[model samples]
Target: MVINLAMKILIGIPFVFGLLVYKLRTRHLSTFNAIENFLRSQNNLMPISYSYSDIKKMTKGFREKLGEGGYGSVYKGKLRSGRDVAVKILGKNKSNGQDFINEVTTTGRIHHVNIVRLVGYCADMSHCALVYDFMPNGSLEKYLCCKKSGIHSLTWEKKQAITLGVAQGIEYLHRGCDMRILHFDIKPHNILLDDNFTPKISDFGLAKSYSNETSIVTITAARGTIGYVAPELINRGIGAVSYKADVYSFGMLLMEMLSLKKNLIQNTELSSQYFPDWIYDHFNKSKDLEIGDAEELGCEERKITRKMTIVALWCIQMNPVDRPSMSKVMEEKFREKFNLVRGGFYTDEVQGS
Candidate 1:
């Protein structure tokens, strides 16, 4: 009887082990399927997986140098199909694998004239890269900071157009997406300009999604660039950071656009301080409105340029609520005269009152 009992137990052990293996395999497949569903819902056009070898060849071992961002350095390259692409190769030392995935998946879903397009990505565990439509003019940062050599200086009109485009892009991300996308980080470096000087918002690694029903989500760590960071980030803890933070960043960006100077050190004065505040501080004065030298302007369109500056100040108000929505910004910008119904500067409410 003892021998027979041992034989039955031995057989049962193998059976149970086999069953466990099968269940584990099934679970993994199910999880993969769910992830796939989420990607589809986000309108991702899942490009075929490309190996690290393929990318290296396409970029000629990353020969053509483009500018670098927080995550990685971008290289201009040509694909197998004679297509031009901007390849962002993530640094092994600086960023993580998750950031690459976020940049790819978040940008892939977003399709807008004002927003940059993500062509594809490479995730080989060790080598990470992001492919995007090549923008010849490069980033807005180059113009404001570097002063492109021998190139025609940025006209006041061009800057106005760029500002309008960028505002519209942000507005679209907030309201147009299936889920509201908070850029979290908005700066001149992230704004890429095409051949025609159209602005496209890029770099979505830090982007977060929220629904209209939910407000004030929790975050453990602080994220975003210096100077462009909203006041809420410094005073309150991480969790308090909200969509309004993005508005503050936008305001800072506007200040930079007008002053044509790096406003981070100046913006830190707090309470809509720095260039935007300075502009508003002197909006009533002719000299202040002429921050951008008229000589830089090709045409004698002074009145219109002054109005654009006022709109930018409105965007950078101390209170997030006082800032106009991206859509409203676009409408008011193109209009001959923008009567901001919500009186001058609201420091209490994040959105314009």
Candidate 2:
């Protein structure tokens, strides 16, 4: 009887181990199928795919990390063509890997200059990653708020250009694409600067797409980071959520860009200051705005600063209906360009939108 019992116990061990192995393989296969199905439906717009081994070789065994954020750790990598790329290996999957699908589908079809391009991707079960052109300047957040003492402040011209670049990028997401993409997150941290300082919007993991005809979309919960999320998103009664939510976020970003330079040195600011309210009190007067560099802005520079400030205020209005559409917001830029051709400054008319 003892010999028979031992034989049965040894057989059960292998049977249970085999069963676990089979279940693990099946789980991985299911995830692979889900990713594959999404890619298959995207026509030919999807970026290149890399195997797990290729990822290791390109990233040099993940030796050089570029940065880390909510999504995952990004490592500097090189493509076969000798071009540099940033590979973001996503964190372990706790859900169905919906964020991976969201990013691939959202950015794969976009061909805008202001939006970041997805060069390739990997969906190797637990080792999924995204590849993109490495922005030499990194994120705009590095420059803003003077995170470190030695980091130089951006010039007014460059600051305005970044503001306009981000505006155009958000505008493209709202109007340029077949489906309106509402980038729920539009903070400075997500804005990447190339070697030329041209801002490219990145990290579309939290983005949502709706038909251009979708004026007011529904969601189960509010999206976007805490500081930048629109009022209507959190409270249903605030207003119907739409592309306007992105406008609200862009407005908040503009506020940060404007106030960051003054934040460190200015001692007169109120305790627990909300920038919009503080800036509003000081609006209409260039010196009162107190945008650093001794508040001694040149004529043209002052006009650009005020132009963006006006746009920013318009964006964060309490009611979504009151906020200007990106189309209306961007329309003023065309007029400003026309004025420049006629030797006129952007001027106060930029306030109309």
Candidate 3:
């Protein structure tokens, strides 16, 4: 009798656990279905929905992979109208579809020359994807950091143009939009370029929105690339969370463009690490910047480099309050007045202006 009772108890335990698992799975599916339905209802203005089969057809069975990142893999595809597009396939193992939802909702409403346009999306069960205009030049990281292999031939003027365009896009997100959007990730990898070398801000998975009534938004934790993350986000002692975090990232990006080196260095001599500090020291002492092959640079190129360096230095100030706003950074008056002197100093007239 005792042996029979013990066997029955074990059987009942498995049965109860199975029932609980089934109920949890059903709840999850119900919630997902509701969110998917809501997204589909709002598809007219934003991105149109595509079935999983349609995504497969567009990507040609994932034949041509453009790249892969922390989120998922991107493939190069062609639309029915023969237009080129890049399709991003989100990984299925994600904890939830929050990243997918965040990207779709945030990028759908934004329309700007410097911001990448979301053509469409796919939210089929277990398969999520986003479609965007094909950027021929890919990301800005290749142009700045990969120039050693002679792949990128961008001149200083073009680099400056890209910087200005990206700044304008960020300014629009911060001030022009109905709600202030904070781009948690603002690195070179997120900046896509078109055939004409025009820079467009891409990747909104980590983006967050706040209303004008709130100046400081609370974040559960730090959300950005390590090298580019603002000191404030990493350590609350630095300052409160604000749009200035994006400014700091942009400053780091600008410095990378000027120096043509990756900010994070590993397996290198101790003295060579922390390139930004070295750059600041050089600038303070009126020393020549260590850009590769200085003799090959023209006078105009030198001037542009100097202007960008000074602006980047100001943008990367330790205190968020000391950093200039994106609007001020985009001011034509400031650019027009900037005149770099031979001694790595600017004219007093420009400063006063």
Best by TM-score: 3
Candidate number that wins on lDDT, 1 or 2: 2
User: Which is the better candidate, 2 or 3, if ranked by TM-score?
Assistant: 3
Residue-by-residue lDDT tens digits, candidate 1, 159-271: 77888788888888878888778888899889999999999998888888878566564566678997787756665732256676776677678767766344333444544
Cα lDDT, all candidates: 0.70, 0.78, 0.78
RMSD of 1: 9.4
Q: Which residue pairs clash within candidate 2?
A: none
lDDT of each residue in 250-295, candidate 2, tens digit only: 8888878877325633577463565444544444233344555435
* lDDT tens digits by residue: candidate 3, 69-172: 88889999888999899999887654266777778777888789999999988876667799999999999988776654486868788988999999999989
Question: How accurate locally is residue 226 in candidate 2, as Cα lDDT from 0 to 100?
Answer: 81
TM-score each candidate: 0.74, 0.81, 0.83
Q: Please report how far candidate 3 places residue 181 from its true position, in Å.
A: 0.9
Ten consecutive residues with minimal summed lDDT in candidate 1?
A: 341-350
- Candidate 2 residue 143 C-alpha distance from true site, Å: 0.7
How far is 58's C-alpha from truth in model 1 (Å)? 0.7
